[model samples]
Target: MRVGVDIEDGGLARITLRRADAGNAIDLAMARGLLDAARACAHGSVRAVLLTGEGRSFCVGGDLREFGALSGAALERHLMAVTDALHDALRTFAGIDAPLVAAVQGAVAGAGIGLAAAADVTLAADDASFTAAYTGVGYSPDAGVSWSLPRLIGPKRALDLLLTNRRVPAGEAAAIGLVTRVTSPDRLAAEARRTAESLRRGPTAAFGATRRLVAAGLSADLGPHLDSEARALAGLAVSDVGREGVAAFLGKRDPDFTGGAHRL
Candidate 1:
């Protein structure tokens, strides 16, 4: 049960799930730490986040040891509490003001894959393999994968992986849009950082607004979508970050964003 976070180059902050000896499996402690780290990142001055695991395996889903010995209502309560705890972490990532990039390698199964999808972008190692391991172990999907994955790759492709519990390799995962990029095992982190930094250096207000609008646009009607987009763009134009960005473009200079001028 280790929690470590650091500021990386180009405003990309990293929160590592640090149980290397246990493959960084999502236990109650790890889940709580993850949620806490994400919250801290949100309130701090960082522009982007990088989520990664410290071991060979990215994550192996819920820790069975946390659930294997429970019984009766105790088991039910334990499962429900832990599940919601994870969902809260997922929600933090889902609603973050800045973009998140996940670096995945080895096994990304069950809730681990859910965490990957919750990220704004993902970079995976070619040797990476993901699965809906829930069914294999007499469980089902948790951590909001059912909702998040479909938003990413669509229902048809998402259902195929969820229903079949099939292994989605890194290359095929990228082809199906599960992963944004695939690289050698050693390069996944660098690739994730590259993308995170790009987002960090862009118009921070525009990125935050776009993320908010697109999320609402998914279920909104056309009129509402336009209304939301218009408001978002209008808001961006007056924002401190936005104004600096526009000024920089016109002045042929780089924009220097100090972060935290507006509330998300």
Candidate 2:
């Protein structure tokens, strides 16, 4: 399998891209595997998620070798098949309430960029590099790159990367808001895990509400956005976890967010 999924008793789900020899490239099998992993992790029991890649590189992108073997109609079919699985996986990850964390290293190109951007927090290794490889290969963006990239880095910067296909180093990526943080290569995995663990203790319902509010901001007017913010805050304030949080603050104690009484 090109993807690996592991869920621990503590509700931490780790998803790894496993096609090391192929630079963790996404082929049909890999896409399906990703879809399956996403489905499995989209559950109330999953408090947080960690996404990473095995071997020297995180992911070099789609399986070009497989793509090269196809004709016109065959190529079209393959593209649809691969995208169907990939888009579903992305949607599943986005729909889940848990915080998403990614630890990326080496070559993060093409769809790999989208994968990293989907994370609520992305920690890129110092040596990691990013590029939008689609245009170079006579293709357009996929895997939410078009949607997420512009939102993360602004339209102009996103266009620069996509049009030029220039490799953005880890430090530059962080500066441009493409990644949440940058860590030394040796510390990437450990740091990402720590981040995930911290988020796991958070109020899931509140987190979900926050995510929705931000997403809503994208297309909403100022008035509508403010309305959403007010509604979401008011709703969460009465939730069990929210109540505990407030009580803990006044009591000078740590709040145990049980993700209380919130259903997905």
Q: List TM-scores for all candidates, in order.
A: 0.93, 0.97
TM-score of 1: 0.93
Task: Please give, for residues 1-264, the per-residue lDDT of candidate 1 as tens digits.
Answer: 455788765566888888888777887787778778877777546678888888898987888887888878998988887787778877776676777889999999888898888787888999899997887878878988888789888999888888889898999989988888899997788888778888777665567777778888889999979988888778877889778888889999988775454543
Which pairs of residues clash in candidate 2, taking residues 3 or more apart in a chain or in different chains? none
Candidate 1: stretches off by over 4 Å: 7-11
Clash pairs detected, candidate 1: none
Clashes per prediction?
A: 0, 0
Cα lDDT tens digits for candidate 2, 149-184:
999999999999999999999999999999999999
Q: State which candidate has the highest TM-score.
A: 2
In terms of lDDT, model 2 sits at: 0.92
**Which 10-residue window in model 1 sums to the lowest lDDT?**
255-264
CA RMSD for every model? 1.8, 1.1
